[model samples]
Target chain A: MSNRDRIEVLFWGIGGQGLVLASIILAEAVGVYEGKNVVQSQAYTAIVRGGTSKANVIVSEEKEILFPQVLSPDILVAFSQEAYNANKGKLKPDTKIIYDSDMVKIEDNVPFKLYGIPFFKIAREELGIPFAGNVVALGAFSAVTGIVKLSSLERALLSKVREEYHEINRKALERGFELAEKLN
Target chain B: MSKNVRLMQGNEALVEAAIMAGVRFFAGYPITPSSEIAEGFSKKLPRVGGKFIQMEDEIASMAATIGASIAGVKSVTATSGPGFSLKQENLGFGIMAEVPCLVVNVQRMGPSTGRPTKPSQGDIMQTRWGTHGDHPIVVLYPTTVPEVFKYTIEAINISERLRTPVIFLMDETLGHMREKVLLPEPDEIKVVNRKFPKVGKEDYLPYKPADDDVPVIAPFGKGYRYHITGLHHNYKGYPTTQPEEVEELTKRLLRKVERVLDDIFILNTYMYDDAEYVLYAYGITARIAKEAVNILREEGLKIGLLNPITIWPFHEDKIEGLLGGKKKVFVVELNSGQMKGEIERIYPRKDVIGINKLNAELINPYEIADHVREGLR
Candidate 1:
């Protein structure tokens, strides 16, 4: 859909990567805290772990979200090489492309603003939690695009999981922000 | 909308609203996409002093819902396509017996089991005619999580007030998608219980019509003994081969809701006040059609959309008045022209066209915009 007025973000990976959870955090960050209209739509098959899953979050300042699916996302985060390749076509010329440097092998000639960040590596090494990689990517994502306040994303992220992981998640998020700042 | 905001799935919204609307008993078979509703009730019902039962199969679930309702409690049952099919026989029984209960069907793409996680509007006709014979049914199709919350209450209220079964239809996308909703306290709204016979047990005729064409049948176990049967029954609740009583029972069963269609029907129209063409859609398809309307509006095309939240007994005259001068009514659905035929039944046959997709994927707005552009040319 041609939702040029709204900010659309797509996070895609295998089924068990917490991509849907990341999108939910982003949606609540914008919709609840920031007081904007937002919708998060997901597509998945029957597969539990390896199947393809994509979550799209669309934010609007004025209009209610009628179309939730993101066909052309302004910010596309691919956590796997397969996801990146499958969704790279028909992107906006100025679309921000963020891919996991650890998992995605990319060609040199890409059209959009591309950033290859090893989100998984940073989360695993800095926080000793590989599963927290999605939160780190959200941190880097907030730093790069300012689609939502880092504090808003942090609050939304904390509410989604148990109490024990919050501290490591905070550090992981801060590390992602610090790393992205240095590169940009 | 209260300040008590929470993020929940569409199925959870329905369950919560059903409870708030005084649905105290649930009998259901859990299935994909719709399992969350059954799970929610299994957890929440006991806290409200309600009952939740997981039936052996869908048919038993349907029968148990009707049974629970007969015992003077508001009851509900939820399922998917396969379970919905299994529930059809008792659904007719509910219609025949004038039982008041809610049936939540979170439709997945299907002939049989089909794609468990994929969404579809394929059950549009099946829901209307799933039960055999001439039966009147009310179906509510809600497009969003919050809408599901609002309509679930309406469905229960309708069912109890009219003494008929109301079908709540949601697709897989709407069933699984999570969104923030402002929940109102149950005390803010007046919850209704079905009317009971005020006369002595000996004076009450089980199937006799009250002033509203609905029988003020007392619930079972209240000493107002009544027989509920699937066979065509007379006012005394006894089966009869007499043609007059059979015809009278059949007509009154339908007449209760048929006479009040305008009061109960809910149609949502957007950008249609000055439009020259209309898009007809519901469920998630209507959501995308609204986006297509925006796109077409930006291009200076005079197009709009009509989404009916009330899905059964299509109100042709009301819709015809709204689409009086429109060039065409595009029936956008995730099926092959079920509702297109329904709309065509209103206008001249060729004035309506079906914009359908059956790939088990949602139809995109750009595809709809392109089709409108082509149709106009």
Candidate 2:
């Protein structure tokens, strides 16, 4: 399992939670910054907010990658309980599952590692940014997977984020990384 | 020297390729799975002093492109499932009027707006039959992102040279998947513009075919004062209901595409020298079918693949000859048995089977492998 050459990741959340933004940042980091081949794809119905949304990103260091969806995700980042339930079946034996503890309750006897971070709580309380939770999850993913370097991730964020929200979201990412390192 | 290859989605590559092909006018409506083409053109066209218009609907979008093409501008329109359905009447109009333009359909799952943002190769037959008429059409299917760029350039050239509307038949997977593509510099590619008639205004007959069966097309505003209409017309471009003239005009319309059939037909065959079984596939499903056949070959089954690039005016005889002594031919597609019927019609004596899916997802290579294995059993 460890011999895998690509880090397949899926980000699941409701609309307006920056699900697509997070995946785009990761794809740009891996593809443009780290010089890895990447594909970032999103799924949604025709409607807009509060709808079920998913962003699938594949980062491969070697070999050409096709098909954007990760049949078995190495890392699953979920923001809501429904998001976690929707993608639980896509985890591999050694997969890593990360969800917001404030929003989702985990089931036991899973075949993979699990980490519950209070992503929403950290963003709203510590950072005073209500919607930066997705960026915080990106930080946590960088800390655990290490497939994407923090510098590359920051560069991607800085390039895409608007000037008004850049500083606060940057702080949120730092806090998520710091908290992620202390988790078992 | 070969330049550095930049990764591009099929939509992005199509835009860049169109610009390089000297396409100056684009009219389209934005729809999922194909909106990027309009966006790419909208952004870059202004930089190059070209034009892109977001029309109110697909019919007007397609019509505007044809109008631009007739006025001596290279033009194109892009759309997906429902939009493709809407543009059919105008597409037939382009056919009857002998208008040269390109129409690209980035296929999504659908009978009617089925899945807006999902990938499906369900538009194969639509490209051929969407328009209601006996008109001849050229449809090219690209399997990979880079080919999307390559075939798009080819589609425009064919439209201009053949003086007919050409379809760049792509699907949601290739339309959305980004990959490395080496965009050709302006000097490295061949671009074809419609052949303008040098004949004086009095002697020029608009529909007269050249020795090669491709008619010399004169731009409407280029002092080539001639009438054009959807009703059957003679070489003088005037509508006529006479039986003899109608017979000649219809034969010429069909023969124009048939004469260049060899030049337009394209397919890729793998391991078919003496294989017992052949898999016929196209668009995205064909890529997975290739993988499935490769695995089956290793597992000691004699299997091969025939992937078509020129979908319409299909190289039927090539397929018929290949399946000459084969035990079975499996046609794989994302829709339920669309291209399989074409395959069966071509190879009447061979046992034909269809492995199809309508789930708005691409059929996996493993699923194709399972089907091939069962067929062997």
Candidate 3:
């Protein structure tokens, strides 16, 4: 019901930034709406608000997911300096790394492709919804990687979030797509 | 129709299935990973006119679940490793009293509170013999969300039919991981209610075994009055000191599950027809081993997976049939070869190799594949 090759993605940021939700949104789009078998998990702990958190999503069109966790990620989205530092040295040469431009600053000596999108800035200043940055990042992820369609991501987000926050989240997602397209 | 196909966690799926299987009482002390089961029960049980209680401790949770089950409702409780340790004593009480309840242990790394957020199969030995007795227990180790859903119903049915506590095992990884599951419609499910006493109050013998070796005990607060104690009991349900009665009662407890292993066993296999080697695994390790089998098969190697969905009351007869002519069996687990020992007890240790991993991280498919390759070379 889906492609044969597996596509692995990782979302990393501080807790409460909604990276876990973003990963789930991407998983829902790929697995539920798009008909692939996917397994998504997050690093959980006693604290839910402040540590370096990670969400790993593996999309496989295989009959069953043999290895549930992402062994190597095709794309890595970082929202904090800690996220970048902890995971930057462990990427394959062709891995796509996207970091929040306003949140993390990196010198360009890495082997993989790096795209810095101002996810938090767009969510805070342009969209007036600070907490919608994860959706913004999801939009950027769709535009940059072309793994999930923008429509799929938007539908997933709309289906997951409440009605009051849908407008700003959609705007945030669109702005993410626009910025990512401009970067390419 | 509302969307049955949605993303959910393993714990959430189990609770949903339990409700469908007629589980109406949940008494649990929330712990990480397994806490979602309690949380789901808390939210959904009340909506269905059931009861959900956050007990003071895991022991109380087990006691309360047993109490509720004996009070004429299907009951369940969930806990993690440390809490599982705490519930062991009362769990034995449920076994001796022949109460039907479900105890879900979502394991984390631990002898104590080792790692709350990490995964472990450390409870493999504990789940079998944790309580201090020779009594039989039915323990199911499900690897995925869908299995959790299906086997939750199966577990409730088994416990109801057998009149014993069923341990439903999950780990931190499966409990927390999200997967897209198509929830089964209610009509597709067959709920098993426990056998209640048919005789009037005068002739009811609470501990008298029927043809199936299961006692149709009367529920508490009913018109029937009888003794229910942890001590060795007679057919009259009172504590007994007679050695023959204790032997008969004890033997009957085990015969309940042993006689029907065919009905309770669920062993999942992949590509077993022509495989030369076996990857023996359970829980999340089985999921990884299944992947390792696929990866090795792509390399033109004949490898297969023998996954035990039911971990305890080891289905030796079925497993023996599956592993008869295999070249080598690799018992892969998240702990230090707990089930490897069990497998070795059947097959010689020389024929069974152990692949062990116990840190917070999961052992990937490559690690398993590499083990097989290294062993072959």
Candidate 4:
């Protein structure tokens, strides 16, 4: 494997979108699969439902993580238009943007590369899953960033998710990986 | 060396260190900048046969922690500004009752919930005097993730050793920042458990001052019957109305911490030996001051940084030694002038300059360098 020092990830969504959970899963993946160090931070407001929350995770092969806030992200995933608009500028020059095209509108004129995935649609249509969009996003992130293996991401999800909803969520994550591979 | 270094945030490291320190009781409410501390501990506590309770409010949470501490368990609770305001009553109770507990105030922008989730170090004075009357408390301010881990363990040790409440005064910046931390092996680190009085119930005086003014505590249900209260009490644990009893009790309570100030105090000196300018800072401000010191050193300026991990009873002797014969001392903090006043009180004649920032953002290193440059002119 190529040895890059750190992988910075920015996961953005509304309060109810499980953005913090997605960041936690990513942190667990780095810790479990690659045995690398990970730092996860989230920003949210007092209002519970409609306010935007962003979880920024930084993974490094060998370094003590400091400054929990990500100054720049190599990978940016947005589940809402507001999240996209608020955080897209924080991406590094050559960073990748993955958004749920069903719920987000990405400007075509934007200079950086964009991967507009129908994450919500895939969760609902392909896997018949409704609340598994965050897991699907994580699957897509694992596939694109190649920071952690797919098996490890699946293990982390299984460990954290409720047992009752595990099956469809696992299917949703697999579908997300399939979709990302085909697009890439 | 374990070689088990991990990149963790300050909040995460606090939890990690607590686990390693055998902390089994955590009761806290979710308040910004400090909620992660609860979240982190909540998840890890169960894995280690510990309990994490999210109480209805900060007041109840702090009370619960004290209850657990008196029940012979290592306990802690974390909070931000407003929640800290709510916890002051119970904190005073802990001081009076001589409870071994840790209270972490992850400070945020605040007069009263000014900024729930933003960073500020304005609570230095509040940590010292928010509670009513005179009481001694050990307060340690950490600057980095590793220090957060180290000092948190130290806070627990001191609280247990001194039989008093200890404050891990964390700011939002340090609490939220991520950094690499080296975890010590299980056998390598020194751990201090609570000292239990060996005497039988008939002869025991709960408030009888032991050596070093630290009394051996007997847990509530440990079969040792003893009276406990927040009132001014005698060595025999009964409330007192006598003037001499109150005076002696009050003086010992304060002296327990004041006597050990030299042993528990610490400050970091960066290139201060032959410096012409001294920048004094703590918490997040210390990080920025170090950066400023480096930049000034690169420019061949005679500058140094004195970053204190122990904020309370500010390290008077060390400050004097470092500032020997220097005419200029710059004190930077996120608050208007909390610690600066302490520095001035310590060295009345020294040219103590205040580089104040209350903008809710951390003071920049460039500002310190500029102040030093201007002072030179």
lDDT of 3 at A10: 84
- Residue A161 lDDT in model 3? 80
Which regions of candidate 2 are displaced past 4 Å?
A: A1-7, A124-128, A162-178, A182-184, B1-9, B241-244, B270-275, B348-350
Every candidate's DockQ is 0.51, 0.23, 0.56, 0.16
The superposed Cα distance between candidate 2 and the true structure at residue B330, in angstroms, equals 1.1
Worst ten in a row by lDDT for model 1 chain B: B1-10
lDDT of 1 by residue, A1-184 (tens): 4445588888988877888989999888877888777887787566578788788888887777877677788999899888778877868888888778889887877778887789988777868888878888888888888778889888888887789878888887788787777667
Residue B182 lDDT in model 3? 88
Q: What TM-score does chain A of each model score against the native chain A?
A: 0.93, 0.93, 0.92, 0.90
The i-RMS of every model, in angstroms, reads: 2.6, 5.0, 4.2, 7.3
- Ranked by DockQ from best down, the candidates are 3, 1, 2, 4
> How many residue pairs collide in each prediction?
0, 2, 0, 9
Expressed as tens digits, the lDDT of each residue in A22-125 for candidate 4 is: 78777866774557777776774574877877887878878544334565778888889887788776666688888898888987677766777888777777
Task: Report the lDDT tens digits of candidate 3 across residue range B1-377.
Answer: 12688889999899989999999999999998799999999999999999999999999999999999989899999999999999999999999999999999999999788988989999999999999989898999998888888899999999999999999999999999999888878999899998878788998899999999999988889889989999999998999999999999999999999999998988888898899999999998898888888889899999999888888889887888889988999989889988888888788689898888878678988889999998888
Per-residue lDDT of B64 in model 2: 94
lDDT tens readout by residue for model 3, A15-112 = 99999989999998888877888899988875568777899998876566757776667888999988777776777888888889888887777788
What does candidate 2's lDDT look like per residue over B1-377, in tens digits? 12345556788999999989989899999998899999999999989988999999998999899988889899989999999999999999899888988899999889898887888878878888989968798999988877888888888898888899999988887787766676777888899888878889889999877987777878988788888898998888899999998998888888989988888888888787878888998887777777677668777888888888998977777668777888899999888888888887877634788888888987877788888778767
RMSD of each: 1.8, 3.2, 2.0, 4.7
Q: How many steric clashes does model 1 contain?
A: 0
